[model samples]
Target chain A: MIILEDVHYTYDGIYTALQGISLQVDDGERLAVIGANGAGKTTMIKHMNGLLRPQEGRVILDGQDTKFMSVAEIAREVGLVFQNPDHQLFLDSVKKEVEFGLRNIGFTENEAEQRRQKTLASLGLEGLAERSPFTLSGGERKRVALASVLSTEPRFLALDEPTIGQDAHQKNRLAQMLAEMNKRGRTVVVVTHDIEFVIENFPRTVAMAEGQIIADGSTNMVLSNDEVIERCSLAPPQMTLAARAIRNVFPEVGQRLTLLSELEETIMGILGGA
Target chain B: MALIEFADFSFKYLGADSLALKRIKLIIDEGEYVVLTGPSGCGKTTFCRAINALVPQFHRGYVAGNVYTDGKNTRENEVATFASVAGLVFQNPENQLVTLDVEKEIAFGPENLGVAPAEIRRRVEELIELLDLEELREKHPHEMSGGEQQRVAIAATLALKPKVLVADEPTSNLDPKSAETILEIFAHLNKRGMAVVLVEHRLDLVARDASRIILMNKGRIVADGNPREILAMDLCEEIGVGVPKATQVYKRLRTRGVDLRNVPLTGVELAELVQEATSQ
Candidate 1:
């Protein structure tokens, strides 16, 4: 769905945000880009959506270089959700915000409204149709931002920090929502710094630092190793550390569990016949 | 005397019908680490600004009752007086930053107050080393990353040597490692006899570090207690606030009828508790 080959992006022709980046994400794949602040995660997402073009290399969406595509054309192929939802949401009403993009693409009023209803209902935002988008809370802003994107029905959805400022329940809901989106055969890429979210949700993890890709592979391998996770400025999950801290007590239990669910299962197994 | 005291204080922002905070009475002991949190619009940030007299002084609204900071009444004390008493690091580092360069930014607060040049030099040097920002000292704000900028913002505020450090959502935008560094910095400051008031949602991160936890809602403090006691309450999870991983494990075990007394708040604590549980 997305490919980056020696992609180099420099903002204003002087400052390089991404340096010679090479990454490929297949359809229906859930890939997480994990890094600290200014690690080029946002830069990478902007390239994927063709918002920023590489000065040196190429960013290809389905084998087509973004250098030739229009913003409207790229918007159809890839939906980008910004970190701050308020910055993207401009319209007064929630329904109107979702339909804004569709209307821009020259959809009929009836078609746009139909698309809005479907997208909101799918994201469980149906009842909030008439409410003012500005009056919504932070989490609601996040969902509405996503609703606006989902209304366009793009093939690949790239979200930058979908779970920021969210509560525990909202975090889980976002996790489940992303999982469901991936299961529905939509390519999903998330840029996040939360280690727990990366460990539990992403099947494949890509680590970046100082405008470069450092590590990319199965989520378990990328996040389990202390050196890699630490170098990327992420700590091991709490359960992984807890399991490691008390490994001596349970000789049979491994300290390799990354998720809480894995630790719970291991604990139950150690307790015998759960 | 309490560094900050609020007795039945309530406030309504300009153009708002309902009170943002209601009947709020909180006394923060000097040098205490208080973790204030609740839902997104729960008025935790409003309460933090009350210490710096931002609520009634700068922000338009109706403020009721009494608020005292460092023996000075909030209503009467000029915001400038609280300026040295309290330093605020807002959530967005980008939005809070005023200067272009890191060193200049760090020196901004003291400059605003017209502190002596020699003291400013000492403070700038102290905070540079304190926040490990020596490498980025001369870098432009736009040149640095978000985490680095956040550190600069805090370092700038810390240079003022405020008696109270009120950080609003300090780590919400940072990565885990950066967030850890931030919390560690807060802990170090709190240890230096500075009252650190952290308004955040991630109670789990500072579960052990906080001297007390005060959960706010609808402009009112709904729950106030020690970390262990307040986190054990079910209200925390329902409202989207988090407890430590250890507390979460204990809550799960308790739901399954397992009597896990005194669950620790960190991974190390959980390890000891598990050992004790297995041995018995």
Candidate 2:
């Protein structure tokens, strides 16, 4: 489990990135952090892995205070995938990139090699193991970056904008992959601007705006709140909007209806059949 | 003549195993808004590059057929010659921004084309206001957000005053509101008689505004037609293209015998359809 108590951070001693944030994440939890650009979503997640230590409060990872732990030490339990894959990928081949993190964390050569092979195969990247990471497409490189971090088998996996530049098929695959990882006892945290993806996959959401956590609750409740959605500059998922638009006609249709299947079922219920 | 034409065009990279674009035959006329989309690596980018002769000219590829811009064959013309005819905005705004600040970046294109200083200044000011980049005029491109940089990139491309604006996934990196703002700008530009050909995957945001939808897969134009007609087909779903959420619901309702008068492209439209159906 991870807990942040009244955390505060600033850049260059001028611009405040996080202002008194307090949150907690349990083991095997699936959470999403969402807001507009410059909302400090990235800065908030940077605290999870000790990339940016809080200036005023404390972050507790498992049982230890993160302020006392080095970034390398905290990284053992927290794997952070940056918004841009290029920042994390520097090795030549995809195989080397995945093994680099494992080797640096003190894993033996044999263990690192076995984990690397399994990670690559799991992400459907075994076919491109020998290819240069720079030569792959944006989506493929993102998978490679994920493979690199998943190979570490960290307790908490925090991803920043994992769905950018991906098509529907790729996004679907990533959702499934993240679900599988969570089932295997890995906690997943995603920071993204893709509202539709959040509504579909994430069960819990934290909405932020201007260096503050505006709202935190179940994904459906937070997204359905007009104030939170407007304050965060987030567009609600299409089905939710559709349900709200006809609320006068079908007052039973809830505002929290986000999934297409949910809306279809409601309409079918009203229509009295297929 | 059409603004751009690809006649039985097929292209292969210098050492690639297969064709990047195969036997593409299409014409994009002036004042038309076209949305080109498909799965990743589906020749959509190559098609955009071919519009400005960047494929065979800049990338050094084997060309099988002909591409013409404003009645000039691309093979016989320089890439620079088509700059004013077909302005292409890349997917990554960071890569295409040449100048430090937003104002200079917008002015760089027309200056290179030898436009008069006064004329360039006029176009730059017009684009800045048009793209709502007034406050960001002095900010560096690298310091701005992804949405702001994309607005600047679009303004820079518009400074050249091309007949057709070809953008490759301009809003992929933007937040939802910013993406809608960018697409609205493209629609506004198209309303003013500048044809816009945008490459994007978020059909939910753009399917309503685009006049035509061109679907590509494996280097081929699999489907192309009116947005409503094309989106109603199962081809989009089979090819992994993101059919709008409202459209998906409409199709499901149709299969279950809830027939609506039209294919709704957006949530509001879908709700209107549902209201009408339930009222009857």
Candidate 3:
């Protein structure tokens, strides 16, 4: 479990990224963070892994203060995949890149190799095992970065914009992988601008604006509120918007829908009634 | 004649085994707004690089056919000459930033082409007004957000007064509203008679503004036609290109025996369509 209490952070003591932010995430919870650029989404995620220390408040992990723990020590329990794969990829080959984290966290040579192979295959990166990291495409590089973090098997995984450059197929594959990981008792927290991905996968969402948590609750409620979405500079999923449009005429469809199948069924029912 | 033409073009990297682009044929007329899309590693980037002669000039790839811009062969003309004809904006905003302040960065391209100081100042002011860069005039690229930096990049490329602008995944790093704002800038540019070639995966965002959509797969053109006709086909979803969520809903309703009159691209249109069908 992770707990944050009135956390405040300032870069160079000039720009404040987080302002009195407080939140809690239980073990095995899947959370999604959504906001505009420079809204402190990345800064808050950094505190979870001890990359950035708070200037005023406190961040606790499993009831322990994170101020005394080193980044390397905190990383054993929390793994963060950066938004840009180029910032994290510097190794020669994909195999070495995935194995580096395992070896750093004190895994044996044989065990690290076994886990690396499994993670690579899971992300469909086995074919690029021997290829140079710089030669891969943007989407392939993103998967390799995720595979490296998955090999560590940390209890909490934090990913920044995991669906940025991915297509429909790749996005589906990632959603399934993260769902499986969440089922196995690992917490998954993702920060993204992909509203559709959030509506489909993440049940609990937190929206930030100007360095403060503005809305936090079920994805359906927070995303459907027009005032909250406008104040936060966020555009809801297209399906959700369409559902609202349909409700304008049919008034009977009360709930906010985020899936196309549900929208189809609702429309068919209305047409049949006519 | 088309402003840009690819006649039987094929290219391969210096040491790579297979060709990155194979026997591709395409054209871009004057003032056309075209969107190119496909799966990852499907040669969309390779095709964009061939526009300003970056494939064989900077990347040192082997070329097999002719690429013409304004009736001049890309291989025959100097890369510097084409810099004033075609402006390229890369994926990452940080990679394109070279100057300290936003104003100086916008003037860097025109400075390189030896424009007069007064003319450069005029262009800077014009673009600042057009792109809303006045508030960020003194801010450096490293100090701004991703969206701000991308705006600076676009303004910098526009300072060259290029006739054609080719951007690869410009909105991949931005929020939805910021992405829409950027595409609206492209629409504004297209209205002023500047052709645009955009390589992106989000068809739902750009399909409404684009006159044509070109789909590629494994180094070959799979589909090329009008945006509405291309989007209505089943090949897009089958090949991994995501259609709009509303399009998916419309397609499902059609399969379930709903006779929709027109295909809608935006969510509002889809909603109105459902209301019309039910009210009747």
What is candidate 3's CAPRI-style docking category based on DockQ? medium
Tell me, what's the RMSD of every candidate?
Answer: 3.0, 2.5, 1.7
> Which is the better candidate, 2 or 3, if ranked by DockQ?
3
Q: What DockQ values do the models have?
A: 0.46, 0.54, 0.69
DockQ of 1: 0.46
Ranking by DockQ: 3, 2, 1
* Each candidate's fnat: 0.54, 0.59, 0.71
Model 2 whole-model lDDT (C-alpha atoms): 0.87
Residues A1-274, candidate 1, lDDT per residue (tens digit)? 6889998888888877788899999999989998877788998998888787788888788888888998778888899999989789988788989999889878999999999998777665677787777655566678889888877767899999887766676677667767777788888899987777777788899999889988999998888767777778877677777888768677677657666666655655554432
Q: What lDDT does each candidate get? A: 0.82, 0.87, 0.87
For model 3, give the TM-score of chain B: 0.96
State the local distance difference test value for candidate 3: 0.87
lDDT of 3 by residue, A61-101 (tens): 99999998989889999999999999999898999999999
Per-residue C-alpha lDDT of model 1 across residues B170-265, encoded as one tens digit per residue: 887888778888999999989988899998766668888999999876677889999888988999888778677767776777776665558578
Chain A TM per prediction:
0.91, 0.93, 0.96
Model 2, range B87-193, lDDT digits (tens) per residue?
Answer: 88875788788889988998999999899999999998899889999999778786788789889988998898889999988887777888889889999999999
On TM-score, the stronger of 1 and 2 is 2
Error of model 1, residue B241, in angstroms? 1.7
Docking class of 2: medium
